[model samples]
Target: MSRRILVIDDEPGIRQALGQLLEYEGFEVKTASGGAEGISLYDSYRPQLVFLDVKMAGLDGLEVLKRLRQADPTATVVMISGHATIQTAVEATQLGAYDILEKPLDTDRVLVLLRNAFENRLLSEENARLRETIESRYEIVGRSFGIRALLERIDKVAATPARVLITGENGTGKELVARAIHRGSPRAKKPFVEVNCAAIPSELIESELFGHMKGSFTGAIADRPGRFEQADGGTLFLDEIGDMSASAQAKVLRVLQDGVVTRIGGSKPVQVDVRVLAATNKNLEDEIAAGRFREDLYYRLNVVPITVPALRERREDIPLLIVHFLQQLAARDGLPARGISEDALRRLQELEWQGNVRELRNTVERLVILASHATIGAPDVERLVGRRSAESPGLGGLLDIATFEEFKQAAERAYLLAKLRTFDWNVSETARALDMPRSNLYKKIERYALQRETVE
Candidate 1:
């Protein structure tokens, strides 16, 4: 499809000429006489780009730009004016106009401006898409007290250049928290380099942290920069830091202390400005006690410690996470958005997500793609959770085995049995369990067709 452009000017000649020029440039163009008509056309056409006259009858270009921005924050608006003034240009810019064009229009300049504007618009949309991908990929969606507190801490820590150590179980979103911190920081525009200490070979760890020159080692085919050099002026996220060898830990400590790195086979140390963020599932203090990790380096990296709560600790957030994952999956698959049935959602909430956010996201994605109906019900959840059970041997699978009706019956039976056992088989215990002032548990005992068995 051709790119759409809308032109709004009081002068008919200017509008016609510009529209023709743009159309010749292979753009689909539309023209409006003034601000009112321009807004109406904008609403109807939803052009990718707009050109507006600065001076108009009812509403000026700046006001039009403001209105357009209000309607669509991402809409690109370019301002045109024959009687250009510094004040008018400034006002247009303040209102978020893409650029100011002075008339009689310079065809070459106009073409250049339009090309640049379109390219920038593409870049802007791409950036938004990338951010969205990152956000969804991170998959930390929730509004519970625990989630809110964690977000608040992330916001506060992101504003500073503090060395942070995030400790959590595997799959608890420590890396996600790290990325969120980097995205919210001043260095967001710069690179965010990640190094997994456990994944890299111990022998190559030094070269990985600090780049190697040509022929630096047996496999040194060419010069390459390390994570520290690449992450200069940004963030270097060292995941599984506890797995790093003692030699690598010492080198990391030096970088943190001196803010400099020396590449292998290179004489001079290169200065680098980088914020360090490290995460690990292991207890670093234990590693230090066991003589596997350096206490000094641990203290340096642990200036600010953040612990991500596991899913089990914040069960209230499970429903919100389910919806977030489904929406994200639907967007990715180009399908109409769908919702989970209340029964399914309730079952999900009861699950102890040992794998935390990562596991929950995977399960939701699976259900969204594989589920046959528009709304996932309890049966679908049972199937998904049941599949997981076959893979792992534990109580994790047991809870998912009970059908909806079976679960309801089991809950009722357990309530009555607990009351009978607690009160030494008193009828009052049954009544209390049934939430009745009198004849409560007895009525439930009769309603559920309860039977008594003597203790051995």
Candidate 2:
């Protein structure tokens, strides 16, 4: 399809010339005589680009430009005039004109500008799609009271600048809550920098939070800005903050009090404006009782305490969460799409998800990949999913099988191994549990070379 160009000029000659040029250049062209007609034509024609003359009889081009922008914020209009002053050009741009072209516009410049404009629009549209996808991916998917209460808390605290302390188990989506707060806050457009305190070694954690000058340590080859400085005018998320060293905790306390940070091995205090949000699975009060976490820092960050409910607490939402994970897996990961039987879903909900939502999502992905049929049955769930999925690979590690026979063999071996471990390697109990003859169970175990392990 060709690009659409609308030429709006009171001068008949100018209109005819530009219209002819655009049409010759393979653009679908339309010409309007005045501002009112141009605005009216825009409603029907809906051109992608417009050339509007500045000086006109009743309503001027600037007035039309303003009206067009008000009607459609994405309208791309270029102002054209033979005697446009600097003020007129600046004013046109201020009103969201794509570009201001002098009268007797250069044909080459017009073509290049259109090319760049369309490319930029394509990128903007793509960015909008990615943002929508991300927002949907991280959306809180539940209608249970716990989730509703959590959402209410998020809405109340999101708009404020008060420090928030998010408490939840390892996979209960603490980061998601933090991101939700940042997205709703006034600093949504700014960068969100996160540092996992537990992941970094304690000896270097202070430098990681405050930065370090060159030659400050063995690996310090250059000066680097830390998480606080990087998050200036934005949000700083300290994940697993209870694991922070005592020195780093004191420094964080000082920065929270003074709004300033001094680099390690450098005494210059640099100011920063950052909203601190922290998350941890550990109980800070217990840490304080043990003399590990500072009480002062605990009070500072605990201004607005939010505890994310575990998956077991919201069992009613398991079905919705399963559906969401299935769709997300198919869309985002390009995994094969599959459905779950009602009984299978019930069985999943019956199990204790010690790892919470993260574990559920992983199990869904595993089923999508490993299940034999398009709709997974309760037997498949029972065979593939183990009590402690965090420890055992089970069917999740069966992807390397070459063919159907190999896949069957690998799955059977895993299932038998899990059963044997569950029965503590008792052949009679394992055979009874499997509902198979003792001789067959022994032969299968011997053939597969199953061994007893202390734990999964």
Candidate 3:
């Protein structure tokens, strides 16, 4: 494919020479005599690159550059000047000209500028495409009442620099909400740094969030910027914040207060401009009461609160989600596209999805891979992902769990629920049978949000 170039200069000799040279180099060339003609042709020609002269009769170079940039912010333009001053060059650059060339244009320099400009354009194009893919991947795809409400809150908070605290059960897509907030913010083009507070060890979490100087600790070989520094001028997402060590939480609170972070072994505090977004499956209010999480940090981070609904809470949107996941799988993973029967979708919705949307997506992926037919039916779903059972989530569900803590919690919840049912919801009997304290059992029930079916 040939790239287009436009030469806008009052000098006939310069225009003809550049146009001929560009033509010989396999470029589609267009020549304009003056700035007025150049601006007029810009709309029609739509050339990828433009070379405009500084000295023009009607419209000046800076004005033309500004107008061109206004017409298309992505315009690639270079200024050609016979007698140029530093201020003139600076002004051209500020007006969005790609580069400034002296009157006697060097063939080598012009070609080099074109190469560089086109290369940068390609990079910008690729970045735009990647951003689109990322946005689509992290899209919140539900129209359910719960989802609509959640999205409404997200929209209300997204445009502000206010800190957000996202709360939800495991696999409920809290990260999606955080990403959505970042995407909608003024800092959308900036970095969105994430740190799984629960994943890092207690011994190293402070250093991880605040950076470490060389030889600060046993394994600290070189100076490294932490999550706070890396996310400066962007967003910092602290996932599973309830699991963060208390010491680290205090440091985080200080950072939020002063916007300054000191390295592990460094005294100097580096200032940062970051919008912090924190998420946790655990009830942070409970965590604070239990002294497991810091109250000060919670207040700082919870300027805006967003709770993502569990999948079961919005079962009506299950079909829409199935369709979305199918399309996503096909586009992103190159998986075979398959349809789900109404019965199958309904069956899926009926199940108690303890693992939330994450669990459903996994189940969908399994069906796409293992189901025999082109379209998935209820029988296939039952055989593959089991039936619509509310009380019992099979051993497969435990095996599907990714994190050890989550597995332990799920196992404990299922065990406790079963024991309570066996005792006919007699708390005393279940507590006695499990050889656990009644108060402890009650606390567990509250933690898991477990309840009995009410007889209507």
Clashes of each: 3, 0, 0
Model 1 spans > 4 angstroms off: 1-16, 19-116, 333-338, 369-374, 387-456
TM-score of 2: 0.80
Whole-model alpha-carbon lDDT for candidate 2: 0.87
Candidate 1 residue-wise lDDT, 169-245, digit = tens: 67788998999999999999999999999999999999999999999899999999999999999999999999999
Ranking by lDDT: 2, 3, 1
Write one digit per residue (lDDT tens) for candidate 2, span 231-253: 99999999999999998999999
lDDT of 2 at 57: 97
In candidate 2, where is summed lDDT lowest over 10 consecutive residues? 388-397
Taken over the whole model, the C-alpha lDDT of each candidate is: 0.83, 0.87, 0.86
The candidate with the higher lDDT, 1 or 2, is: 2
TM-score of each: 0.69, 0.80, 0.80
For candidate 1, which ten residues in a row score worst on lDDT?
389-398
lDDT against true structure, model 1 = 0.83
Best by lDDT: 2
TM-score for candidate 1, please give it: 0.69
Better of 1 and 2 by TM-score: 2
